[model samples]
Target chain A: MPNQHLIEARGVTKVYQTKDGAVESLKPLDFSIREGEFISVVGPSGCGKSTLLKMVAGLLPVTAGTLELAGKPISGPQRDVGIVFQSSVLLAWRTVLDNILLQAEIRRMPKAEALAKARQLMSMAGLAGFEGKYPWQLSGGMQQRASICRALLHNPSVLLMDEPFGALDAMTRETMNLELQRIWSESKKTVLLITHSIPEAIFLSDRVMVMSERPGSIAAIYDIDLLRPRTLDMMGSPAFAVFAKKVRAHFYSQGTLDH
Target chain B: MLRRLLLLPALRPFLLIILLLVLWDLAIRIFKIPAYLIPRPEQVVQQLFAEWPRLLTESWKTTQATLGGFALTILIGIPLAMVIAYSKLVESYVYPLLVFSQSIPKVAIAPLFVVWFGFGIFPKIISAFLLGFFPVVVSTVMGFKSVEPDMIDLARSMGASRLQTFFKFSLPQALPAIFSGLKVSITLAVVGAVVGEFVGSNSGIGYVLQVANGNFDLPLMFAALVVLSTIGVLLFVAIDLIERLMIPWHASQRQVF
Candidate 1:
């Protein structure tokens, strides 16, 4: 029997109308995310990686072709999908718990249940003492952790992350990777992360989808045979190097390696 | 240390006022300037105490008009900003008129308001509303426009309804900016009320200043001026306190010691 696909994209494309005329953002592309799978898309800046993710999240309209989540055609924002943007984007006026609870409040979830889930996600994200603190008080990495917890608060099946750790320093990025992997393992939610860093993409994803510059289309997809519970050690190993090389070769072919 | 820290901001301004008063007293004594030319700070204080009953009543009248106009500005300006911020069509229609109104000096319209509404507080309140309304509208429109696009996308992605997106994200995000407008407009509200009184009112601190000016009673003029400034300061502080309560999470509200 065929494996269950949670997210399906069939010849999806995006075109933006501008003062300079029509701009093709994403070329016709097809892909599917299996149930509880972790997928990452790596590409250069301005290569429509973000546009593709936004389309999938139903935040942006797909200009052409078909995209579906579960069995339904995605015409607008869906209830069972959550998104994490490049920045933490936590509201400065709200405490961490309040920011996380934003998702619950939007969905109109029961207050008692939402509060319980918020506390659980906070502790899981290692943000126990910081719940009542404002977002500005948390460091870059901690803020992003709280953002992830916020995305997961509603228990959505699909979590779409767009360069979630791109703002952090290298050392913080690595720690956040481990934290994310731990969260993913525990939650078993389908995640599609968009990133610029090759190693960051390979370290977190089950399969890495590489795309070309401008009018971005999938150039290649590599399935990682690396073991579960991936760590910093795995990034230094020979096997990880091989996967990184493959993802890099696509950027080289497109001559976008400089980006 | 804590007490010093708490009191220093208040203390510095108070000390400066005292030093200025001392300087003024010395200048008057050393130069032997006539009281009619410039009343010493003590004479102004004495005048304020001697005419306390009349001064208090006039100050109260100005205060009522200022507050009434400010309350009206909040009611009208915010909704006007909402309409302008949300719809480009409405903005194009309304924004030019707003700019045009500003071009005509609000003080020039104060007497017209008196002619239309008679010598009542209605003209004073209207003048205050006119002066206060523009800053509120402009600042609020700017605040509404400044909401980060990513924040809007985040709200939309969460399956938030249009109203939910506004209440949860847009309104809260615009709050600090809105408070900034309120702070500016509250001070202007006092000026508006005073301008109306200057033009034609028989009561209010502004009218007191006018009578003192005609009589060349410098001490009384100084006292009325002090009362006007006091009202401006108190209104500004009230709005500031409200801002602190409303948006303590804002970076501006974070106290550093």
Candidate 2:
């Protein structure tokens, strides 16, 4: 049988050892992300949402508790997971296609297979004609799209994005939300997105995970009832507002001003 | 159409030079400066033609010494910068020593090189390297260090080995800064070669200038100066061209053409 849980976390916590003292960055957290599920973690800035994503990606370690992907503990950088940071972080030196092909280069994927896969991903991400352009030559949204293409090039089972569209403008962010839904469905990859925007969390994710202030722990997990192929108009519907309101209320309850 | 051609960016520098030469020729005629002091621009041109063979041979020597030193500097500087960029412990040990080396005037240290290595082209190359390598090391280290932590995180996320990360990501990221450092050092390398020749060389433009000084050959001295400046400018252009080739993607290189 296919694994029910692609990623499972049990009482995961992070405490950074600073010169001042041990600062708790994340509370003991228990969660599991199902295979092919789209999940968005919504919380205030510095609420350790990024810390959680980093742990999932195996870029950072948990101080306590177990974090697993495909039943293997996440100890270091994983070959099976891809991560996109808030910034696109495209290498200015490499062209769009070469930047995406970095995945193949690092993973030692075959050249022909990797190139074909990259070409398809580029078209899916609406970056079809920008294969040769450098990062600086592209717009903010296009650059982020190229980075997203890079993350997906390896065909990882899970894509961990830490506010991938956070740097984009409102209009571009809306357009990207639609593009992401299409890509996620077409790619059939489980996604764990971290974002502060309530609408973004609700619009993109199958479930929106709300977190409390630093020493961040799960405040609530709301299942998004919206239909598949979620359109921008659906985001304007009452159902979307209700989810947005619920996620927003968690922040107000904590008296944390950060969004 | 001619006015537009003169205003063309590539041609502008030459136009300013020609205009300056005319003003210089006028000043010499109006002031009636003696030939021993400031020769007329035409007199310097005449001397340039007269001494072309000798000047070409000496210039070739200086060019070899300067280039040999510069090549050595780049060879040593970039790898040293890489070592220091990645390790703070090594940096603390090496950075201060580099500063101390730079603190000693290279001109003052010229005689010591002659004493140690004798008055061969080797001493001149050594002098050029000593003077030129420091900026290259400093700027390249700064370049490597300036890379975004996010870029590195991205690399590591993909399972990029540390060596792969540096060569593919960090090295190219640092190229612009490295090239700027090289441009500055190339000019200094020329000066260092001249200093080496000053300390006891019987060849190069420096030796030619010294000989011209003794004989009161002002035009020859002017010719030598022109050759030195020409060498410096040409080397700078060469580095700039290399930078353009190496990093056409870089924003700085975009508008430069």
Candidate 3:
């Protein structure tokens, strides 16, 4: 059954050494998400949620345990995994279209094909007219949207998002969430998102994995039984409240650990 | 907009020259200053026109030496910076030597260059190259090393090869810093060429200034000085124009006008 999983992490642990001595960022953790599933991992700041995502993305080396994507061990960054960070990081000098086409250029794809894909993705993200505009010329939300389009331009199997909407305002964040949900449904690419917002995690993800404090381990995993094409009305429902409460309790318990 | 334009920052030297000319004209008329001691702006302008042909030829020679030396500096400086930036050992060995060489007074060594290369363009070109090389190397090193760590990591994670990362990220990002260095060095190239001519030379504005001084032709000397200063300003403006054209995305190049 684990072999069927798109991504599987077994006994994954990460330790970092500082001047004070060894600091365990992540404990032995086991997690998996089925193919084409949207999963969100939520935890407090400094809880190693980012570390876990980095390990999965192969940006950081795993200290122990094996992590695999589609039955292949993740030895290094895989071409099939696309990452979007909190900051748009869109290369200030490059136009939105060029930034989106970066993956294709790096991968040495055919120029004509890459240009076509970049144009399609730009329009898909509602950035058709702004293709020639540099990153600094765009608003924060627009830049982040361009970044998302860039990640998807490569047509990767999985999207690794590390707090992509964390920097946006409340209104823009909600709009982006809906836009992301729509994009995900259309593309059908598996996504692993890291977020501290409980409602956001429940809203965007099919499964929310609550993580504990330093030496972070999965405290719990809550599956959202809500119907497909979930709307904002679902957030006021008792089911959503219950899921949010459960995730909140994990954070409260994490706070109590300091004593 | 026209009113706001008048409030724009003025080059102090240009304003100073205008004031100096006013004082010179007044001192010559009121205090009965002799023509040999201080020449009026009108006399200097006349001298400039009278010697226009010789002045033009000398100006061309100096421009050639200055430009050739600057071109040489860029060809050698950038590659050297890249090597030093990529290797810590190379930086440790090369950087100190570079600093030590720059600390030596270039004016003091101009005569030595003339002695070695003779009274020709070679000495002037060499001097200009020596003056221009260090700033380009220093600025380029800063640019190459100043690439954000996160950006580098992001590129690497995308499976970009080292060469790809350098070309795609490092070099473009370094352009702004490198151009600032170039702006400084372009002005220095003019000064270096003049210094070379001052020590020993048969042509150039510096040579003309020397001949005027020997003959006590103060107006001719002032005329040569004016030409030299104008050349420096013009070269600086040319570099600035190139910077705007090449790296339009740079912050400095984005003029409000």
Candidate 4:
């Protein structure tokens, strides 16, 4: 039997009231994510993918319909959710370890346990011997890793990442993608990652959801039948190419949407 | 490379200032400038050494006024910026008033302060505060407003309360920019204190300069000027050091040695 859905959205929409008029950012979007599943949403720039993630994370209010996380309607920012933004957004005044401990501080977790968890998360993210270093000393990729460690520090079951690797270079992005997959697998937390790269979505996600341009809505959701413990070498394989082509075909047929 | 790196801290600025001082001393002597017209470097330094006790007392008075004004600015300015940052209504009501107040030249108000508060330290402190207050308010407002929207969103997503978000994220993030304001305001505080002293004061570097001016004692005047400038530079550097301590993670603070 299929595992119960950890997150459920029904006809959720976002309308931003501007001076000009009411602007619809997201059309009615419906999707369900199972417990411990890795889901990726790929779309063009300004396609409202980030809006959908925010709505589910309870960071933004939905104009219509409903979004339930862990069987409760998301009204405001809930403690169980963790989000990583497009930029690392690490506080420049905080060191790496302190940055991770910020989540514990917010959640009011036990100090000793949080410190131990932070150390474990740092080692997992390959940030050993770098806890005392400040965010400016780190590369873009390392900063993103620190942010990810921060999000996971509180042991939140749901991870919402909005283009976490979008700011990194090509090589760094690939490495981060792999590292993210490993983290996701090890944590077994439900993840909804929003990205523009098709290969990245197909490479990391169990199910990839494509979004349309303006007044964005889900266009398609493709299941990746690829095996787990996936490596970069898989990206060169025919199976990976086929999955990537399937996602690309929708974008190309419509227009240049991916950015 | 090793030598260059070792000397990188103070070498270039030190050499350049020495060169400028040499040029200034030579130019005064070569021009056959009168003692009243221009004091040579040695004359100014000699005057500084000769009246060390008196000048030191005056310097202390000026320093006290500057510190008082700067502390008041920090007390009042940051909270004002916080109000502006948190509420649109407050910003709309207060921002215009701030701009209007800043437009009134502080020097013009210094004499008025003396008239109202009498010729005491209070007038100097108030004058210094008035002059130094605007930059702190303006920069702090900018700092709070300029926080990346995504960062706020990240805090919200993590279920951070408004207070938590402010204390943990917005306040710390705004620090580097706030320090920039502090750096500018502290030097201005020195000028503000002197301006108040110039209007009406029995003691202070400004008062000494005024006495020397009336007597045509150019060397004493130049000596007071040196002391004034040294106070401004030292205050600015102290602010810089605090910025480094508070926000070493900030990009602006991460300079190569």
Candidate 5:
């Protein structure tokens, strides 16, 4: 059978040695994400969900196991992958448009073409009117959206988002979640989101991977069979509640499993 | 109404200076102070115009030395900061020595600089560099070392090379701190040049001040002092303008509410 996955991780483990002692952040893990799939990795605080994301993004070294992106061994960060974090991380000095154009500039792409694409992405992210404004001048949600636009400006094959909307307020977060779903459907890039929100994971992800505490490993993977074009109404459905309950149960069990 | 409101803030300082001048003139006239003891503002202005050519030449010399030394400081200081910031071993070994050297006042070393480099612009420039170098290096190091970790990670994850990270992120982020250091260094640069001139130079404002003192030319001395103060203010304003032009994103550049 042909491997339809865009990214594959097998027997992955991460060990961190501090001044006090050695700590294993992530246990040996095996997972794979299919092309154009939105997968959210949900786990307790201190779990290695972030560590796993970092390794896949090529921001951290894998102590063991293999990670393949587009059937190529993960060596270092590639321009083909875009990553976003909780913080907007937009360059304060650069205007919104310029910040989005940074990736293109770094890649040495043609300025006119890059800018045209950036303008499209900005409009798609609802940031067209604030193109000249600095990051500090924009509201939190707007800044986060600009950052997302920046990540997508290069047309990366994979989007790795580590709690990108975690810092926003409730209303903004919900709005952003809808915006993100829209963006994802529109872009059709494979996404691996590391989030702590169960409802968010269930609402946005095709598969929610619940992780165990320290020396973290996947406790279980819950598949959401909900139909496409999911909306806030789907979040209130009984089916959504069932899916969320299943993931929450796995998290509860993992807390006991750690003992 | 708008124009008047715009002028109000600046007018306060201008009015304060005028009040100070009026008070000084009145005190001199009422107390019948001798010109040798305290030259009146009018006398100083008259003397300034009379000795304008000499005063202008000396001012030019001092300005040249200050600027030359400041340029040299930037050339040396930024690289030193980069090296120290990039290497922990170098920082640990060199940082203490730098602190110890700075503790030795440049004024005390002025004569030694003159002895070594003679009564040329070199000694004065060296004095200015000594005065200006520490702030530049300290600020540059702080700027380079204090980059946000997330920003670095974001750049790294984009496959940016080490040099690209430094140029794109580190350098820009450090600009505000570097400008702060430059502002302090530029002001001190003038004082350093003047001190070096006072020690041994045959020309420059400090030399003119010494000549006026010997002849008891109080008006001339006050004129030199005014010129010196003006040079310091102009140099500082130049640095501020550059800072505004270069790093307009800095919080310092923002207007208060």
Candidate 6:
């Protein structure tokens, strides 16, 4: 059988040395992500879900075991990955266009190409006319969209999102979920998303990996059997409800997940 | 029509100044106050014209000292702040020293600067630097530190070097705060320069004040005060304008009007 895995992790663990002593965060996480697959990790607040995401992004070092991308060990910040943080994190001083172009600038991409690509992404994100506007000028959803545009500007192979829409209101979050699904299908990149909401995880992911509480290990992994190009209407369908119930069961069994 | 024109933001301050000057002249006349106490606005304006050449030269001298010290404050203070922000060790060792340096009054230190550097523009610059740099260091440090660690992580994810992360990420975010510090520092720099001049100097507006007081030239002293205040207001406005230019996207610089 052909190995379609684009990202591989074997016995990966994270131990944070706090002032109190060694704090175990993740206990030997073992998972693999295939190319062009959308994977979402759902867990309780202190379940080291974010810790695992950061590790995959190569922002935080894994304390032990192996984490590999394309057969190469991820030793440091991986240039092939794009990250979307919570809170939008848009620079207040830059215009929407410049803010999106910031990633290209950091990578020393050719200015003209970057500008063109930034404009294209802006239009795709429905921010075409607002290029000259600042972050403060845009609505919360718009600012987050611009940040998403920024993450995709450099065309990284993998997109890692850590609760990117957690700050948005309910109505906006639903719309963003739809847009994100479209973006993922069009971009054809491997995606790893960390989230708290079971419905969101099920709606966005090919496989939802549920993690347990502190010193988190994968509690269960469910492969969604729903048909693709899924619609918001499909969310009420039997297959979707089954996935949602299965993910929610983990949270209810492991105590509250209000986090 | 005249009232409507004066209501414009640009003309409002001038309108207020004129109103105050008229009120001042009326009060002096009605109270039958002596010229020696608070010179009439007309008499002060007359004195200002008569002392125009002297006031011009003195103001130029004060301006040079203020700008010099302010330039020094920015050059030294910002880098010093960056150093402290970049390292916890440096901040631990230097932050206390900074606080201690600020504790000893700058006005008291001015006389010492005169004694060391003599009664030259150098002492005035030194005094202004001492007074102005503290605020810059404090504000710039705050600005740099306020950057979200996630912002830095994002930069690192893009392969941004430390220097790149600072200039490209931290610097722009910190600019509004840094500009605020500059505004405060510039005003303090004028006071600092004047303090140095008062401690020991033959030129500058402060020196002119002393000479006018010695002869009891109240009108001339009032004229000097006007000149000194004009310099302070102009420099503060200059820094404010530059902030608008540099960080137009800043919340403080956002368009409300």
lDDT of 3 by residue, B9-61 (tens): 67456667688889878888999978777888899999999988988888888
- Better candidate by lDDT, 1 or 4: 1
State the lDDT of candidate 6 residue by residue for B1-257, as single tens digits: 98788799998898899999999999998999988888888888999999999999999999999999999999999999999988999999999999998989888878898889998899999988998999999999999999999999889988999889988999998998899899999999999999999989999999999899999999999999999999999999999999888987777767832
User: lDDT per residue, candidate 4, B1-257, as tens digits?
Assistant: 97886578677777787898899988987888777788888999999999999999999999999999999999999899889987999999999999999889888878889889999999999888888988999899999999899888877766678899898889987887789899999999999999999999999998999999999999899999999999999999999888888877677767822
Off by over 4 Å in 4: A255-259, B1-18, B255-257
Model 5 chain B lowest lDDT segment of ten: B248-257
Among all windows of 10 consecutive residues in model 4 chain B, the one with the lowest summed lDDT is B248-257
Per-residue C-alpha lDDT of model 4 across residues A1-259, encoded as one tens digit per residue: 2478989999899999999999999998889999999999998899999888888888789999989988899999878878888888888777899989988887889999999999999999999999998887899999999999998898888999999998899999999999999999999889999999998999999999999888898889999989998999999999999888878877777666642
Docking class of 5: medium
What would the per-residue lDDT of candidate 2 be over residues B87-149, giving only the tens digit for each residue? 999999999999988999989989899999988899999999998999999999999999998
What lDDT, from 0 to 1, does candidate 3 have?
0.87
What is the C-alpha lDDT profile of model 5 across B175-211, one tens digit per residue? 9998899989998899899999999989999999989
TM-score of chain A, all candidates = 0.97, 0.96, 0.95, 0.96, 0.96, 0.96
lDDT of each: 0.91, 0.91, 0.87, 0.90, 0.90, 0.91
Model 6 regions more than 4 Å off: A1-3, A254-259, B30-32
By the TM-score metric, which is better: model 2 or model 5? 2
Return the DockQ of model 3: 0.54
- Candidate 6 — what's its lDDT? 0.91
Question: How well does candidate 4 score on lDDT at residue A204?
Answer: 95
Off by over 4 Å in 3: A1-3, A16-24, A254-259, B1-37, B255-257
TM-score of decoy 6: 0.95
- What ranges in model 5 sit over 4 Å off? A1-3, A249-259, B1-11, B27-37, B254-257
What is residue A142's positional error in candidate 2, in angstroms? Answer: 1.9
- The TM-score obtained by model 2 is 0.95
By DockQ, the best candidate is 1
**Candidate 5 local Cα displacement, residue B132, angstroms:** 0.9
Per-prediction tally of clashes = 0, 0, 0, 0, 0, 0
